[model samples]
Target: MTGSVPVHLEVDRGAVLDGDLVLPPEPRGVVAFAHGSGSSRHSPRNRAVARVLQEAGLGTLLFDLLTEDEERTDAVTAELRFDVPFLAGRLVAAVDRLGARPDTAGAPLGLFGASTGAAAALTAAAERPDAVRAVVSRGGRPDLAGQALGRVRPPVLLIVGGLDTEVLRLNEQAADALSAPCTLRVVPGAGHLFEEPGTLAEAATSARDFFLSTVPGPIGT
Candidate 1:
């Protein structure tokens, strides 16, 4: 009842991306998660959201954006967090692999991103329009995606914590720069991580609705 389907993706840059592929017993669509800076596929909050999506019949992909050595090296300086393009490229390749799978072939593809991961996710969406359907950012930094924001064509949902004021301003700014259809939802009294009880649930609910509305259709009829 609780398990994962593992997968490996080779990036164009020669690095391998490791991930967990979890499919619903009968899936409606597929969601590829982009973990925030300093976080990985094992993030409890994202894993919590993944569990929610799984129960809702959506497939999930959770991966580490950095290698163990890179993580150790960057952990001291937090330098890798700004590698948006690098992470985005890896996501594109991962999507290509998952989107081609028999189980995911016919399902709409969505991106669920957190924190700095949101920046990379949006950047990837801009680059791979043909593959990404919908995008959701949770307490995320979509603004960091930079000019790539102008190229994102998929519907985007930015979920922010009401208590996280500065980020809200940034999300608002990024939302405006995005020509793609987008919405911003703020969770009152919640901080950047949405650790408040029921806050993450609320974020997950908003994300689910966005994916259901923006993604294409049911898997292969």
Candidate 2:
């Protein structure tokens, strides 16, 4: 595909996830997005970043980490969203699924995570270091990843809003724990959501540049 295509991924134990996959021709790499908190594939911020990646000749997979029923339950209990291990497992499944697909097989893989999803992305990258080449987090809670942060082998780019001080500090601490090459970027005048006028664009551009430089380009390109 050229446009966003709907996909169903069977992650774990018959738990299927809905997603939208957008691929550019001869993409340099494929990025799997993990939305934070209770957010799903429809998150406008993640979708915006995905579009930027697609425009830059990278494929993007935006998927839900939880099932509909689980979402309903999480809405009330607020449990599943914070379970980093569970979310990371689902993300690893998605990564493996993408690796096995004909269109994305052999492509350099990356993860783009937001909020708590960032922690899950780091944990998943640690589990699949041989497969994941790069990682990028936007206003993420990488500290929540805990011990797994030290195991991530791929280069990491953690983007934080300048105004989101607590999260920025957490990312700083997470960076100190990472042995892999890691860069912490701050988008000035932006809050946790990057809702400011041009901050999200800056973060998106930084992500694009990082993936382009770190994730290996297409073979023979």
Candidate 3:
């Protein structure tokens, strides 16, 4: 239970996704990743962050949000990627699947979302307040969550690139609207993709720390 393993998550009869699951011995919590639009379980940036979470004794799941056919269609139409409600429903299904698994059922859950996925994560958190303990958004457009922003009860950490001015401003507005405990961290010299040196690492570390503090452990463990 301490290494990376591949998993198949069935979101519904129509969608079955591939994912990578990494767990430490008796993990304190589990984090599920929602990659940005056009990205998947193989995103190197998300994989890097998952490694950090795994090393910190938190189990991590990086999964694809769409099927191969859907990905191909989305590539052409760019429609499904921005459909926040659809993505949120998928995320909720993923969370339910995780909860039903014996290995992860006992652990509190956290969500780490990037770009459009962040909005999905926030919306999912609101939809399943009892299941999601915390959420972290990286270079995300949380304003896209709209009214769901007011219903997310779990603590949230919004990590943005300082140079990604528009997203930063949007995150600031989302922060003000969030009813839950929320913190906004801006990484200087980084852009929307956090392609700048050391910037992604900074965002990942903040996410790690946020989950560590906010995701509650078992009461008597």
Better of 2 and 3 by lDDT: 2
- Give the Cα-based TM-score of candidate 2 against the true structure: 0.97
Ten residues in sequence with the least summed lDDT for candidate 2: 212-221
Model 1: lDDT to the true structure:
0.87
lDDT of 3: 0.91
RMSD (Å) of each candidate, 1 decimal? 1.6, 1.2, 1.4
lDDT of 3 by residue, 27-110 (tens): 889999998999998999988888888778789999999999999999999999999999988899989988898888868999
Candidate 1 versus the native: TM-score?
A: 0.94
Better of 1 and 2 by TM-score: 2
Model 2 has an lDDT value of 0.93
lDDT of model 3 at position 180? 98
Winning model by TM-score: 2
All candidates' lDDT scores? 0.87, 0.93, 0.91
Residue 126 lDDT in model 1? Answer: 94
On lDDT, the stronger of 1 and 2 is 2
Ranking by TM-score: 2, 3, 1
Off by over 4 Å in 1: none
Candidates in descending lDDT order: 2, 3, 1
List pairs with backbone clashes in candidate 2: none
